[model samples]
Target: MKTWLTRCLLGGLLVTSPALAQDDDAPYAYPEDEPARDEQQEAEEDAYERRRRQVDETDDFRRVSEEEGEEGDFKELAGVDDPNIGFAVELIGGALLLDSSEGNFAKTVAGLGLRATWEYGRTFNLEPLRENLWADLRWTYGSYSDGTDFIRGDTGVHYFTVAPAYELKLGKTSLGIFGQLGGGIGYQTTSITIDAAETKVNGIKPVFQYGVGLRGRPRLSNKLSLSFRVEAMGFRRGYLNDIFLGGSIGTAF
Candidate 1:
């Protein structure tokens, strides 16, 4: 977020008393030590004022300027630019293993995930671990099967979630082991069918998600760039708690 600073200039300095300014030629007029400013000087001062008005500061105290070099840096960091910081339109698929929670008996669900990232490696320009830092935005949806249809007739454990994640690789290689930590809102649903009647219950609750795996990105062309990760993850919320073993395919720009 941006916080604009209001400029409060002293108008009295520019708008002198009419009696003094108009009576300059009269007796006991004010003595001017500095020469009258030329048109060029006035224009320069006006330009300076305009430039001052163009500066805006961000929440992290980063200064944003009208200059393209600096402006682009800030915009990309804010994830406002079209070609975000990293991967875009990445499609991921994985498997979720449901836990032994009461009132709901479901396990081994197939899930799909979408991940987009705003990497900070360029914005911050730090060395060593720079390549591993990014702002992760992910959404996951799944179609899972209910473990046993005999006890609860037919049961379904399904969910869709959105989370902000943090990921970092262990080493600086195209194929490196990485770990991710994320938490966000998950709208989980539990469906049960007894005889011929079907009933579902769902709620929006906080999710606990984490994953670790090996990923590879060989640095291909922007349009053809591809990356993948195979991970063992744990997903949990108010409705269900389970571990996930999955892999993902991502395209980077």
Candidate 2:
């Protein structure tokens, strides 16, 4: 009876083992899906690679823009023949002396002047003229104050000048030479007491004169400069024979 029971148990185990083996084989039925899984994985990897390349391209473009900005080449401008043009102002200061005084006596004169200059050249020539010639018209108004005994009085004078100029450039500096020929009328008033009354030296004296001058300019830019000028004028009338001298420091723009 024990032997028969053992054989029955062995038979039951053999039947169950075959069913388990069949179930394991059933899981391998769809072999075709393996290739699809592999393809999906490869597609995902390709998409990741494309995204990385796009990010890299954006970074490269940004870097190039930053470098261009740092170089500052975009700030440079072009197309002008010369950057300098238009009107300017100058302030003049210097001494005055009567030309006919004959070295017998001298009086001290101090005065101020206002002037305007124009340029016609298109190039920044060390010499700023055409064939070394430039033309300018200026008006000068000034007063003389005296502290000496020879002629103790205050005098005012007005004159206009037409100057044709020339220039010489040395390195960054420019030296100008010019002469003017023009005339204007003037009057003389005096503070001397004649018979207990202050009197005028002369009434509406007519003044006529010519002058010569020198100037210099230092470049501050292609368009701007620092300017200096000195000029001397001589009168025509023997009595009004006076030497008018002046200096100006200002800007040319």
Off by over 4 Å in 1: 1-85, 102-106, 145-172, 222-224, 238-240
What TM-score, over all chains together, does every model reach? 0.54, 0.50
Q: Candidate 1 local accuracy as lDDT?
A: 0.61
Report lDDT per candidate: 0.61, 0.61
Model 1 clash pairs are none
Model 2 segments more than 4 A misplaced: 1-80, 100-103, 120-132, 135-154, 166-172, 191-208, 237-239
In Å, residue 148's CA in model 1 sits off its true spot by 9.0
Q: What's model 1's lDDT at 23?
A: 52
Encode model 2's per-residue lDDT on 1-253: one tens digit a residue. Answer: 9999999999998888553345564576467666545888899999999999999999986665445345674422222355666445688777766543446554446655677767644333433342244455655555655545553556566555555445444445477566656555554544564344455665555556677777777788977888887888665543646676778888987
